[model samples]
Target: MKIACSIHACSLSCSNLQHGGQRLLSFPLSKQRLDQSNLRTMPKRKLSQSKILGCSRNPQSAVGAPRAKNLKTGQAEEKGIGKFRFWTDARRFKGSEEKCIVQKALYEAGGVRIGGYPKASPIPGPLGFQRPEDWDFLWAPARLALKALPARPGQLVSACPGMMSLTRKRQLSMTLKGSLGEDLAFSIIPRTFSLPDELEAFKKYLEKQRSAKQVKNGSAAEEEAAGRCKELAVGNSAAASDRNDLWILKTAQHLGKGLKLVTADEAVREAAKRRLKSKKAKPYVQAQQYVANPLLIQDRKFGIRVWVLVTGLNPYRVYLHCNGLVLFSTHQYSSETWRTEEGEVALGHVTNYAQNMDGMVWDLKMLEDHLGKDAFDTLWCRIARNTAMVFSSALPQITLAHEALSVQPESTFELLGLDYLVDDQLHPWLLEVNGTPSLAVEHEDLKVEAIISKQKNEMVSDMVKTLNLASRFEPRYTSLRLAATKTKSLAAISIEGSEVEEGRSEHTAVNVMSDAADGQTTSSDPQEDEEADIAGVVQNSSMDVSTDGEVSGAAVASKNSTRQHEIRDAAEHNFTEESALHVVSGGSSKTVQTVISPADRIDHLRRQLREEMAPTTDKVVWFRVRQELQQLGGFQPLMPMFPMKSKSDQNVSGHNMPWKDRDNELVSMLGKTARLNKRAAIAAEKKP
Candidate 1:
C-alpha cells in the first residue's frame, strides 16, 4: 500500500526518524492538528487550540466545562500543572509577622515570586536569590554520604565531618565554595570574556555531540528560573543578560508553566488576556538582545539538571552525583526561528520533564555510549568538579553574609539543584542554583512521577550510604570500644608465652610497652620482673630498653605491651575487614565457619545468586543474547515492574521506549522464572 506523505501521516512515530526527515520534520505539528478536522476549514473562525501536551481531548464536552478548568487543564496553551507550593525563609522577616512563609498553590505564570507572599515580603534574602548560601545550605545528604565512605582522616569530632577545630563552619564553607568556583574557571571553564575565536572554538562540541547521538531527549526545566529557561553566561558582561531575562518569561506561557510571553502588540495582549481571565494582563519585560545561538541535539536544544551535596561546612566539601536527567526540546532547534518569535517558542528551548515528559532520559549510559565512553566520562568528571567549584568559590562570602542561617555543621546538610546548559564547545554553563531543589516531581501522568521518584530515590539512597547513616544507627563505636578492651585480653595470652621463652617474651614485652605508651594497655606480668622494668622504660621514652649483655626489665615490659597491642589490633581489624567475608544462608540453623576475604565471599555469594537467579538451561534458548547480563552482577535492565498490560499501554502508564518495551527480554532475566512461567502458561492456553 502506498503511504500518504502529508502532514497527517498515519502510524508514524519517533522511530520513523530513520525513514528520513522529509516526511517527519516539516509536518511535525500536523499530528496535533489531525484530531481538529472540524477547525481546519474554519481555522480563524473556529479559534481552536490543541493541548500543548500530547493528551487527546473531546472538544464538544470541553466546551461545556468551565474556562478556568480548561486553562488549568492547559488545553489552550501548555498543559496546566497542579497546585505548587513555594517556601521562603521567613527569618528574613524576623521583625515582621512572617518568619518563614510556605505559600501553597503558587501560580508560576509570572517570572518572579519576588514579593508575592506574607502580604508584603521582605527584600532580597539568602533564599530568594540562588545565592551561594542557598547552594551550600542543605548539608544532610553530604553529611550522610561522608559518614558512609569507608575511608576518612579520623573520627569526626565536631558537627562538621573532619573538623580540625570548631570555630567557623560558615566561613570555611563560603571560602571553599569561592575557591572552587575560581579553580573551575581556571582549569575547566572557559573565561567568560574569551575572545570571539575562543567562543567559536567551543561551538565545535555541538557538532561532536550531534554526531555522537548523545542528546536529543525532549527538554525544559519548569522552575530553573521562576518557571522559565534562562541563558546564564559565564560572565555578566555578555549581551545575553536581556535575552536571559526575556526567555525565562517565555517558558511560563509558551512552555505551559504559567502564561505566554506578552509582546508590545495590543492585539496579542488582548488575545492572551482572554486565556488568563485577568482584567489587565501582566506586562512583558522590555525586549533587548536575543540570546545568541544555543547548542542543539539532533536539531533540538537541550539542558540538564545537576545536583550537588555539600557534605561539610567547616572545610567545605561537595558531592556531585554521577547521574542526571538530560532533557531535549520537543520542537527542533532553530535559533533563527525562536529569536524572531520573541522567546515564545519554549518547546524549542526549555526541557523540564513536565514540558517534555516523553523526552526524559534517566540513564547516563546512553550519553556515554554516544559520546565515546572516555570522552563522555572525562566531560562528566569536569562537570562535577565544576559544580563543586562554583559553589565553593561563593561559600566564604555566602556564609559570612548569612549569619542567621547558621546550623551545627554535622547536624544539618544541604542539597543544591543546579541547572546547566552546554554550548557548542561542550563547556557546561551553570544556569541557576536552587537551594530548595524540589525532590518532588508533580505531574499529571503517574508514570512520569514514578520515573522521577525512582530516579530521585536512587540518588537519595546513594547519598544516604555516602553519609554513612547506616553506621549511625549501627553500634559501631561501641563495638570498636569493646574491641579495644578485648585487645588487653589478647596480650595476656601472648604474655604467658613470653615466660616460656625469654628472648621471644622479652621482644614481645618491649613491643607491648611501646604500644602502652600510645594509650593502649596490657595486663602486668607478675612472673617477669624484667618485663615490668622494660614496660616502664618503653612507656617513658623511645630509647632502646635492652643492653648488650642483659635485657632491661623496662624494655621487656614494653615488648610485651607491644605484642598485646598487635593482637588486639588484629582482632579489631578482623572484625572490620569484611572485604573477604561472605555469609551464606544454609538449610540448617547451624553456624558454619569458613575463612575467606570479604571480596571472595562477596564474589561467592554473587555467583550463587547469579546461579539461583539464572534461567534454566532448557529454557535459556530464547534469551541467548542476554545471558551475559544474567551472569554479570552490576546494573541490568529488566522489563517494567508494572503489569504486562501497563507495559504495552504507554498511553495509560509505562516508561518511554526502550525502557518501556523490555518484557520479552525480561522473561529471561534472573528471578523472573515465576513471571516467565505464568506468561508461558497463558501463551499455551491461547495457542489453540
Candidate 2:
C-alpha cells in the first residue's frame, strides 16, 4: 500500500519527475497500484513491470487458484478482474524504461507535481539565493581580498581577476545588446554636452581671428591711400594743363609788345650838322696869291708860284727867315734872333759832340762849325751826352721824315732841288719854300697843291737849315783834278804793259830788252814775281820775246848735256848698288843685271856697303848679332867657325882679322888653321 501511495503521489506531483518515478514503480506493489488506479496508469504496460506483476498468464486454464475480494466490497472478484492482457513475449524492457513510462504518465497529467520531493539537483543555488552576508564575501569580497594580496612579480596589483571576468562577461553581453541603447544617454551623453560648449568657444575664437586678420590686411589705411592717390593725380594733371596754357599766353603777350625803334639815317644827319656848325665858328685866313717876278719868269720858263702859309706874320721878313743865320753862325750860340721881311725868328740849335769820333765824325765836325765846338760840347752835356737825343730834338720832324722818305741814292740837302738867288758876294738868299719843285716841264699840272698838302716844303726848309748851305760855299775842284791826273797816269802805265805783253809790232829791240829786263827786275820784287810768273805761265805759248842781250845755241846745248850726264851718273850709281844687294840676297840676278851695268858694279857695291853701314844698318846688325849670340848660348854651334861663307879668299882673311883679339883667339886659331889646311891642299894639287 505504501508503494501504491508513493507511485500515485509521485505521478501526481512529480510531473517532470522521471527517474524517481521508475524507482517507485520498480516495487511490486507499486506496479499493482499502478495497474489498479487510473491516476498513475499507463496506456500500455511496460515490460519491466509485467514480470513483477505476472500479468501475462492465461486466467481460464488456471487450476484451483483462490480469488481475492475487493476490500471496499463483499463480492468475490475474478482472478483477472480489471486487468488487460499484454503479450510480453513480443517486448524487451530496459532499465530506464520504467522512468520513461512514468514521464509519459506525468506529461499526460498536465504538469502535476509530487508534494514530498525536490525537483532540481543537489548543488546550491547562485549567490543571489544566498544570505546578504554571503553577498559581500562572494565575488565582491573576493575581488577586494585579492587586491590586498601581495602582488606577484610582473603583475598589476590593481587588476582583479573577478572584475576582469565580469568585464569579459559584460563585454559579451554588450555584443548581444547591439543597437539597443545607441540613442539613449548612455551612448551620446558626452557628445551632447561638449557640442554646445565647443560652439560657444568657437564663436569667441572666430572673433579674435577676424580682428587679427583686419590688423594684418590694413584695408582701412589702404583705402585712405587710394583716395589720396586719386586726388594727387587729378591735381597734377590740372596743374600741368594750366602751366601749358600759361606758356602760350606769355608767348602771345611777348609778341604783342614791339621792340624799341631806331633809324640810322637820323643819327648820321645829326652828326653832320654838328660838324658843319663847328666849321662855321672857326677863324679863317684869306688865301694869298703868290706872283712870279719878271726876272724869275723870264730866266726860268717855269716859275713856281709859292704860297707861304705862316702861323704868325712878321714885323720884318728877315727875322722870320733867320734859319740861314742860325744854321751858318760863327759863334757857339745856344739861341739866336734875326729879323726878316715877313717875321722875327728865334732859333735854337743842338750839336752832337763826341770825343771818340769813330763813327759820324764828319757829321760832328760839320755840326761843330755850325755851332762852335764849345757850344756843341755844352749842348751835348746838357742832353746827358746823348747824340740821338740832340739830333732827334734839334733836327725838325720834316727833315727826319725826308731822310726817311728819300729812297735810292740817298740825298743830303746839297743834292736837293731848290732855287736860291746868289747876291753880289755869292751868298745864297732864301725865297719862299717851294715844295712843288717840279721836275716836270708842263706848268699846268705840276702837282703843286699835292706837294703843299704833303708838307714837303717844310722838309725842304728844314733841310736847308740843317746843312747851313745858304751861306758862302766853295767847290772842291782841285781835289777832283788831282784824282783825275792820278787815274790818267795809272791808265797809261797799264796800256804800255799790255802792249808789251801783246808783242805789238811798234816796239824796238831795245824796248823789248828793256821790257824783258824789267821782268827780271819785277821778279826781284816777290809780289811782282808771283804775278809775273803766273802771267808768264798762262801766256807761255803766246809770248814773243826780242831781247838785245842773248845767249848762243851751242852754249845752251852744252849746258843741257852736262846736266843730263850728271843726272844719269847719279841714277846709275843708285840703281847698281840696289841691284848688287838685290842679287846677293838671292833675288833675280837677271832682273838686277838688266837694271845695272858691270862697269858700275864696283860703285854699286860701294854704294850698297855705304847704305848697309849707315845708322839704319847699325840697328839691323845689333838685332842680328843679339839673335846670333842668343842662339849660340841656347844651343850647340852647328859649325866651329861661326858658319860664314865668303865670296873671295880675302873675305876669309878678313874674317880672321875680327877674331885676332885674345877674347876671339880660339876662333882666330880655328879660322887660321882651317885656311892654312885649305891653302896647303890647293898648293899640293898645283904641284902635279
- For each candidate, what TM-score against the reference? 0.33, 0.12
Q: What's model 1's lDDT at 547?
A: 24
Q: Give me the runs in candidate 1 sitting further than 4 Å from their true place.
A: 1-291, 339-346, 401-406, 441-454, 471-688
With candidate 2 superimposed using the best TM-score fit, by how many Å does residue 568's alpha carbon deviate from the native?
65
lDDT of 2 at 582: 22
Query: Ten-residue segment with the worst summed lDDT in candidate 1?
Result: 18-27
Q: What's the lDDT for all of these models?
A: 0.35, 0.23
Which candidate leads in lDDT?
A: 1
For model 1 the TM-score comes to: 0.33
Off by over 4 Å in 2: 1-396, 399-476, 498-688
CA lDDT, candidate 1, residue 250: 22
Residues 1-688, model 1: lDDT tens digits: 1122222222211111111111110011123323444323433312222211212222221111111223334453212111111123333322232211111112221111221123242322122122111111122223222332221111121123332111122232223323443343434332221112222332343335333433343332323342222243222232333333232222112223533432112212332332343444443311111234566657776767766664443333345666566666667764333333343444565555557756645445656676678877676755765564455345434344223433332333455566666776666765445444545554455665565555565665555444433222111222222233333434554455554335434434654564467553333212222211211111111112122233456765786465344333433343223323334435456766554432222223222222222212322222222322332222222222222234447552112212212233443343466578799999999997
